[model samples]
Each structure stands twice: as C-alpha cells, then as structure tokens.
Target: MKRSKSKICSNEHAKFIKQYKSKKLTILFCQLGLLILFICLWEILTQTQVLNVLIFSSPSRIVSTISTLYTSGDLFYHIGITLSETLIGFVLGVGLGTIVAILLWWNESLRKILDPYIVVLNSLPKIALGPIIIIWFGAGMQSIIVMCVLITIVITTLSMLNAFQSVSNTKILLLQSLGASKFTILRKLILPSSLPQFVSVLKIAVGMSWVGSIMGEYLISSAGLGYLIVYGSQVFQLDLVMSSTLILCVLASVMYLFVALLEKIVHRRLGL
Candidate 1:
C-alpha cells in the first residue's frame, strides 16, 4: 500500500514538471513567431512601396547592407571593438560601484558625507559631460569606457546600497546579539539576502553600459557600431544605418539574455 502511494505521488510530480516545460516552450514559440511576423510585415510594406524603402529600409535591404559589411571584413571588426569596450565598462562599473556600496554600508559617517555628492552626480546629465570627458580621456577607447562607467556606476552603487540597507533590522540585531562581528553579519546575512537585488542591478547596468559605450563612440570613435551609424547618416546610406541599429539591438538582447541566464543559475543554486 505504501509503495503504491509513493509511486502515485512520483507520477503526479513528473506530470507537473512536463506541463511546466510545455508551457515554457509554447511561450518561447509565440515570442519567435511575433518577431517573424513583424519582420515579414516590414518587408512587405517596403517592397510594396507602402513604406518608403529609403526611409524605413526593408529587412532585405538591411540584410544586403550587412552582407556588404561582412564581405568587406568590417562587420566583425566593428562588433569586436564595441563588444570589448562594453564588456570592460560593464565589469569596471559594476565592480567599482559594488565596492563603493560596500564601503558606504560599512561606514555610516562616510556614507553621510558622500550621500549628497552621490545624489548630485546621479542627477546630473552624464551626456553634458561628454566634451570634458573627451578632453580628459582623449578620443580613444579610454574615453568611451569612462563614459560607460560613468553611466552605470552611480546606478549600481545606489541600487546595491539600498539592497544592503534593506536586509531585515531584526535579523541584523539578532546576529549582533549572538556576538557576530560586523563583517560576519555582512558576509553571512546581508550579502546572501541581497543576491536578488544584485541581479536586478546587473540588468539595469547592462542597458546603461551599452548606452554609455555607444554615446562615447558617437562622440569619438573611428570604428564601432556607433561610428558606423554616424558615418551611414552622413553618407545618407539609410540601409547601413538601419543595419547597424539592428545589430545593436541583437547584441544588446544577447547580453540581456546572458544576464537573465545568470539570474536563473543563481536562483537555482540558492534554491530561490
């Protein structure tokens, strides 16, 4: 009787898992179908002259432009430059921001002193500082990276500081009462509790990092997707412009998806 009941329970659990996977697959298919439909409609409209090809630029034209770039051997070169800059900026921004946040969390006096300055910097328009940044870091990749770091760092710091502060006061106090040092409480309790928020910060930082890098490239770059966009516009090659934009969208989506995958892995590891 006991064995029969256990077998029934196991079968039900298996059925539940199968259903869950089927639902996820359906959602994935729907998303891909929607994208395909949009692309087809876009192509159809442009081919029929309903939408001006010069202005809207059909998917086929964009594909042709991409092919030209590929044949010219510039496609991967530009992509590699932009990707490397973005990854570097993303890492530096997130790492430095988190370290600053931890320091702020550790020292209340320092946090108070710097709070207003941090807020002011965050509120100030980062783009307004572009000319100065170029002058300071020159027209190279360094300036572009600095711009990316500037865009993402403040947001990461603020988000992470909030996450650290949001850990339950009661839990913190209990740990203190149990004679745990400040570092122990932070290491064992606060950091673990803030993992979800860190993931959220990563999502936000990904977009910011891309924006910063592209904007920097717009200001001063000889080779990058942003430079291609600028050059295409100058030459009135709308196809090239559209193709670069499409590539940017694809690259950004891939980066975001990577962060999402990391989030899933973290959640699973923590049983969250």
Candidate 2:
C-alpha cells in the first residue's frame, strides 16, 4: 500500500512538472513574438512617415546610432559607469535597509519613534534632494550613489518592517511559550516567514535603484547614459536620445528579470 502511494505521488509530480515546462515555453515564445511585432511595426511606421524618424526614430536608426557609439568606444564607458553606480547603490540600499528593518523589528519603541520619519521620507520626492546631495557629496560618483541609496532605503525599510510585523502573533507567542528566546524566535520563525516579502522588496528596490542612479546622472555627470540623453535632447540628436533610452529600458528590464529569477529560486527553496 505504501509503495503504491509513493508511486502515485511521483506520477503526479511528474505531470505537474511537464505542465509547468509547457506553460513556461508558451510564455517565452509569446513575449518574443510581441517584441518582434512591435519592432516591425515601428520600422514600418517610420518608413511610411506616419511616425517621424527624426523624432520617434526607427528601430534601424536606433541600431545604427548604437553601432556608431560602439565604434566610437563611448558605449561601454557610459554603460559601465551607470551600471556600476546602480549596482553599488542597490547593494548598499538593500543591505542597510534590511539591517534597519531588523533592528526596528527587534525594538518596538524604536520602531514607533522612527515610523513617521520613514513615511515622510518615502513620500518625499528624491529629486528635490539632488542639489543637497551634490552639496554634501559633490558632483561625482559619491553623490550619485547617495541619491540611489536615498531613493531605495526608505522603501526597503518600510516594506521589510511591515513584513516582519505581519508574521502571526500566534506563532510568536507559541514559540515564546515553548521558552524560545527573542533571537531564536526571529531566526526560526520571523525571518523565515518573511522571505516572500523580502523578495518582493528586492524587486521594488531594483527599479528604484535604477531610477535613482539615472536621476542622479541627469543632475550632474560627465559620463553615463543619462548624460547622453540630456546631451542628445539639448542638441536635437533624437537618434542618440532614442538609443540611450532604449538601452536604459533594456538594462532595467534585465535587472527586473534578475530579481524575478531570484524570487523563483528563493520561493522554491522555501517550498513556497
């Protein structure tokens, strides 16, 4: 009887895996098809002058502009600079935000004291702080990183804190009744239970970090994709602007997909 039950479970699991793989392939193909269709339509419209090539810029023209930048050796430098700042800011913002959230979760009084300030900061426009950041850290990488950090940190902290707090009080109380220390309860129950929210916050932080980095570059930068956009607009080089914007979109999409991949890995490990 036990052997039969085990075999039944195995078959069910195999069937589920087959279905999952089929759905995944379907989604991937659909996404690729939609992107190709959009590009084709864009090129057609531009060729027909329905969309002005000078302003909207065709896919082919954007590709040509990207090639020009690559041949001139400016593409990688700008991308590298922006990429580095965004990544550093992302790491620091998420790290520090998580740490602060843990501390707040551990201390109720401290959480109460800081909660209002966190809300206010999260609601404030990060761009308004650009001039102040420049004053504090100067028109360099330091200022750019600071901008990214500021943008992501508050959101991260609040998100994580809420996740921690939302863990069942009954679970916490049951653990306490079992003589579990606060630290042990956190380690065994709270943190583990908060994994889903942690992944969610990371997804949010990924986009915030990019926005912060680009906005900072817009404010003051000798080099970076954001600088390219600003310069292209000023000189009416629409192709350059379109190309830079396209690259930005691609990079941001890549970052978001990376976070999504991480979410799947974490979910699987936690058996969610």
TM-score of each: 0.87, 0.86
Model 2 clash number: 0
- Deviation from native of the Cα of residue 39 in model 2, angstroms: 1.9
Q: Model 1 over residues 71-99: C-alpha lDDT tens digits?
A: 99999999999999899999999999999
TM-score (C-alpha) between model 1 and the true structure: 0.87
* lDDT, model 1, position 12: 80
Candidate 2 on 28-109: residue-level lDDT in tens?
9999999999999999999999998888888999999999999999999999999999999999999999999999999999
Pairs clashing within candidate 2: none
**Model 1 misplacement above 4 A:** 1-30
lDDT score, candidate 2? 0.93
Give, for candidate 2, the lowest lDDT window spanning 10 residues: 1-10
